[model samples]
Target: MGTDMGKKESLLFCLDRFLDPWFGYQLPYQDAIVDLLQVVIVSDNTLSVKEAALQLICDYAWPPFPVLEENFERVEAELRPDVSYAMHMDKEIETDS
Candidate 1:
């Protein structure tokens, strides 16, 4: 897990320093950034790492994109493999409570 965490941190650092600065500001490169982020998220099976990547996108990368909420949702759905299952479980727990 430590190695996984390190890898995740390294990827995030690279994205923030290099990819985010290069592709983040431009509208045309937004999809590329999203794709890169998705690759990072899917590269690790750790939920915390995936969540961190998603949070990074929400906090930083999504801001300069054209469509605000739509891009967020689209990128999130594409990156998070268990999103639908998680949502369903949340709803089930909510109704049971």
Candidate 2:
């Protein structure tokens, strides 16, 4: 995914390390970030990428947002973040007991 896999990983790690502590664990992946932003960041109570980013950062003040593609300006507040953009997905891993 445009060589930005690391950034996505960082985002997921942030959410997991911070959010999971308070909200419980989840699949740490790009799709998680995208899904979370859609549900938490894109709120009617506020608008704009900056606002969404601010709220998101506030929500999980552990691992910070990394500077990479920084692709928020392209989207309108009316639009939603979709998990469909996450790339290189594999079937759910079955861990050995």
Candidate 3:
């Protein structure tokens, strides 16, 4: 498990490097970007990383290719922007409880 985590971290680092230059630059490779993002989305990784990838996809592919939009919807459906919980807690506590 530790080895797997190390590998994932390494891959993420490499991806970060590869993507850093294209932060705000326009590119002609729409297909490549979409494909890479889809791989990241379905990869067994942390939510934050997945969200970042999704954001990048939206940034470059905003016109919405079918596959890109489908992946975007999947990530959106799994996110809970309004919810928060205490450390190690399963759910948020009610103030009036």
Preferred candidate (lDDT higher): 2 or 3: 3
Candidate 1, position 59, lDDT = 44
If both were scored by TM-score, which would come out higher, candidate 1 or candidate 3?
A: 3
TM-score of each: 0.39, 0.26, 0.42
Write the number of the candidate with greater lDDT, choosing between 1 and 2.
1
lDDT of each: 0.53, 0.39, 0.49
Instruction: Identify the leading candidate in terms of lDDT.
Output: 1
Clashing pairs in 2: none
Q: What is the lDDT, from 0 to 100, of the residue 32 in candidate 2?
A: 55
Model 2 agreement with the true structure over 7-33: per-residue lDDT tens digits: 544554565465544666555664455
Question: Which TM-score value belongs to model 2?
Answer: 0.26
Once superposed on the true structure, which residue ranges of model 3 sit more than 4 Å away at CA? 1-28, 63-77, 80-97
Candidate 2 differs from the real structure by a C-alpha RMSD in angstroms, to one decimal, of: 13.7
Per residue, candidate 3 scores C-alpha lDDT tens digits across 19-44 of 55556545567567667666666555
Query: Model 3's lDDT to the true fold?
Result: 0.49
Q: Is candidate 1 or candidate 2 better by TM-score?
A: 1
Model 3, C-alpha of 75: deviation from truth (Å) = 4.9
Clash pairs (backbone) in predicted model 3: none
